[model samples]
Target: MSMNTFPIIRVVTKLLIPYILLFALYVQFHGDYGPGGGFQAGVILAAALTLYGLVFGLEAAKRVAPPKLMQRLMALGVLIYAGTGVATMLMGGNFLDYNHLTHDVWPQVLPSGQHLGIFLVELGVGVTVTAVMTMIFYTFAGRQHIT
Candidate 1:
């Protein structure tokens, strides 16, 4: 079956992708205090893109998220994750020690640097995972099957 065979499916997929992405964000942001995190959020994000690809066809998906873009995103995410650790080290603490991420300007009523550090790290993880999974899907989808 080809993409044109299911117009309803395509329409439904289009309708759902935004909500899926939104939910992914929710999981990412609430991860530190709840059941979700970078990994779960990442998977959800990737799933949304994957659903788009399955519904709209692989080429369309690739156009939406090119391989070069995915590669850069993967690198950037890793850098963000590692940079947090390096920053802490430079701040006179061990790697990934969030205590060193503090700033005096932060209000007493607000959460501390630990929360900020975790958020950054999780953001990185989510980015990397999304790119990796999307790339993986593209890789397999782009391959020519031997008949």
Candidate 2:
């Protein structure tokens, strides 16, 4: 029942996964300018990886993105999100405030740090979501039957 047994599926999946990943990145970065955002991007990224797992098998997917790595990424995303808030606070602004981010360093930039803050927060959210979804898929797929 190996995926490689079917050459067509294997080749098609291999060709498609890269495009999926590229689109995910596009969604992630372009979210600020358009309709897409962190949540959507995260789901897209997760879906790509999930597709990879489905086509390649659970073990292969795990080898590529280990559970431990995903767990760490989840924590890291939270830290990035929270740290942005903390940074704003340290800059003498309210929690989650973006204006303070640029006032002290680059006051000349129009729109200030708001956009930057939003981007960072969104990135954090995307990372967290991608990791969680992949982890969940791995857990459910890896379960063994208890007879």
Candidate 3:
């Protein structure tokens, strides 16, 4: 069936998208100390974006979530994750070996830098997951410009 130019759907998308996104961000950020962390938040955020595209069509969604920008952001997110690992390796250890990061590579105690690195990597994973899934949904919708 065709879902083109539905006034009701347009109105619904306008009203709901803002709230959904706000909640999604809340979940993404606030989950660190509570139940359901970044991954779950990313899924929810992706779902909200997908729903916007599904109801309003790909073109409208693209105005907000541009495919090219989304692609770049997704790549950047993954780069952040991988960069953390690479940095650790450069510091003289295997992938994601947090121990390699510190004021002194051979320090006796584990530095807080290791914890910070892991947190950054996890944040990158969440960002990539959310943006890439939204991009995929937009591509799947394929700019339905039916009238």
In terms of TM-score, the best-performing candidate is 1
Order the candidates by lDDT, highest first — what do you get?
1, 2, 3
- The whole-model lDDT of each prediction reads 0.90, 0.89, 0.76
Off by over 4 Å in 3: 1-8, 90-94, 99-115, 143-147
Model 1: per-residue Cα lDDT over 8-76, one tens digit each:
998898899999999999999999888899999999999998998888888888889899999899899
How well does each candidate superpose onto the true structure, as a TM-score?
Answer: 0.92, 0.91, 0.72
Residue 122 in model 1: lDDT: 96
Model 1 alpha-carbon drift over 4 Å, by segment: 105-111
Clashing pairs in 2: none
Better of 1 and 3 by TM-score: 1
Using lDDT as the measure, which candidate wins? Answer: 1
Alpha-carbon shift of residue 55 in model 1 (angstroms)? 0.8
Q: Where is the poorest 10-residue window by lDDT in model 1? A: 102-111
- Decoy 3 TM-score against native: 0.72
lDDT of 3 by residue, 22-121 (tens): 8877776666556655677778888887877777666777888888888997998889889989998998889988766675644565346655565667
Separately for all candidates shown, the number of backbone clashes (residues 3 or more apart, or on different chains) is 0, 0, 0
List RMSD in Å for every model shown. 1.9, 2.2, 5.1
